[model samples]
Target: MERELALEFARVTEAAALASARWVGKGDKEGADDAAVTAMRVMFDTVSVDGTVVIGEGEMDEAPMLYIGERVGIGVPPEVDIAVDPLEGTNLVAKGLNGAIAVLAASPRGSLLHAPDMYMDKIAVGAECRGRVHLEAPVKENLRQVAKALDKLISEVTVVILDRPRHQQLIEEVRQAGARIKLITDGDVSPGVAAAYQDSGVDILMGIGGAPEGVITAAALKCLGGDFQARLWPEDDTEIARCHEMGITNVNKIFTMDELAKSDDVIFVATGITDSFLLKGVRYFKRRAVTQTLVMRSTSGTIRHIEAHHDLDKKPLFKDHRIKLLGE
Candidate 1:
């Protein structure tokens, strides 16, 4: 993959965040998602890559999504596998809550795992804990390993998990293991990636999250020189059959970071739609909306935080909406 494409991905996610931020606090989840998807699709055309959507929206429910197998980009190459979550936390955006983001991951063809959209049991940590945490390991044991690796006491290591009923037992074990917990609702991508950054105050991340998001997380961790592990948690026959259709015969097999994002040149980019410890959300100025994005490259092991100022008038359709109060 070309290193140049890394910045191109930032534009793609920035467009999505910029478009969706308009609906913040409107309490319209689907509407916000639609806005984001539309913006992302438009930006993909400008990036020169022959891309295939291995992981996209619409797999969680019947709602419209950037379906799997969808082709994006201008038909150019380094033929790539593309995965996107235009609006990672629709509910968060709809409620004007923090943790909403627009994320995209791209890798050379056959480099990214075509994970079916379903639940995936995941465990992630920074480079310090790499080769220590395992998905099959007991929850407390993983936390212990991370705490030891980070040179923190059992009570000091902080683990982040999605705030859901499904994670009750996992949370309990973490608590019993004496590690702190950060329970989040809706978005896992930020926290998952944040776990790999020591400054992020997130030492570990584990739980069942969307498999598609898992692949995206793996890409980011790969670039950050972190460790991530996951096992497909297919809920039923439908999801299992879907996995088989993708030629995944071992649904229970654990996937390491290298397997999930196989390419040495994977690119991961994400623009925060709402505030979080990892990245700041989009901020609207007079005539432009400023977006903060995180871009990473696995080949070079570089991570960048970009702040872009957009010119609303140049946007395709939201010119009026974005610059309405600017009086242009």
Candidate 2:
């Protein structure tokens, strides 16, 4: 993959962030997601790459735009596989909460996994503990290992997990291990990204989230030289059958970061829709909207934080009186 594709991919997420930021706190999660998908799909037309959606909203029968199996971008060289979450945390954006972002990843064709839309049990940590954290290990044991890797006491290590009823036992075990927990309402990608960076106030991420998200997180962590381990959690026989159809014979087998993202020739991009410790939320002021984005390319080991200022007047998506209504 060309290194320049990182910036081009960032443009796609930035457009989605700019559109979705207007729907923040609107109490309409679907509306916010719709705006983001529409804007993102529109912007993909401008990029020059032959991209296929390996992971996206849903399959063609389920989602109208940016669906799985959909071909994106103009027909060009450098065929790429894409994984996208137009709005990572729809609930966060709806309630005006934190940690919502627009995220996507692209790699050479046949690199990213076409993960099914099902739950996956994952354990991700920064590069310091790249090969230390294990999915099959007990929660407390994994915590102790990560703490040791970071040179921190068990009491000082902080773990991030999604706030879900399915994680009740997992949460209890972590608390018993004496590590602090940061439970987020939605979003699995940001926390994984945070865990990959030492200064992000997150040391490790655990518990279950969307399997497709695991692939996206793997791509990001792959760039950070971190590790992600995942196992398919089939809720029912139907899900198990789906796994087999995808040629995944062993649903219980754990997948390493290399297996999830395949190679280091990958690019990850995210634009914050709400403020968080990792990236700033979109800020709109005087017909001008500012956005903070994180872009990474594993090939060059290059990571960039881009803050873009857009003149809303020039954006056809928000023209004349439309910008004022969004600000209101």
The clash count for each model shown is 1, 0
lDDT of each: 0.87, 0.89
Per-candidate RMSD, Å: 2.5, 2.3
Tens digit per residue, CA lDDT, model 1, 194-291: 98887898998889988988999999999888999999999899889989999899999999999999988889999999998689999987867899
Tens-digit lDDT string for candidate 2 (1-328): 8877889999999989998888899887777787788888888988999999989873322433477788899979889999999988888998999999999999999999878888999999989999998999999999999999999999999999999999999999999999999999888889998998878999999999989889999999999999999999999999999999988989998999999999779999999999975799999899799999999999888999999999988987566332223434
Q: Best lDDT goes to which candidate?
A: 2
Give the per-residue Cα lDDT of candidate 1 at 286. 82
TM-score of 2: 0.96
Clashing pairs in 1: 50-76
Poorest lDDT segment (10 consecutive residues) of candidate 2: 319-328
Which pairs clash in model 2? none
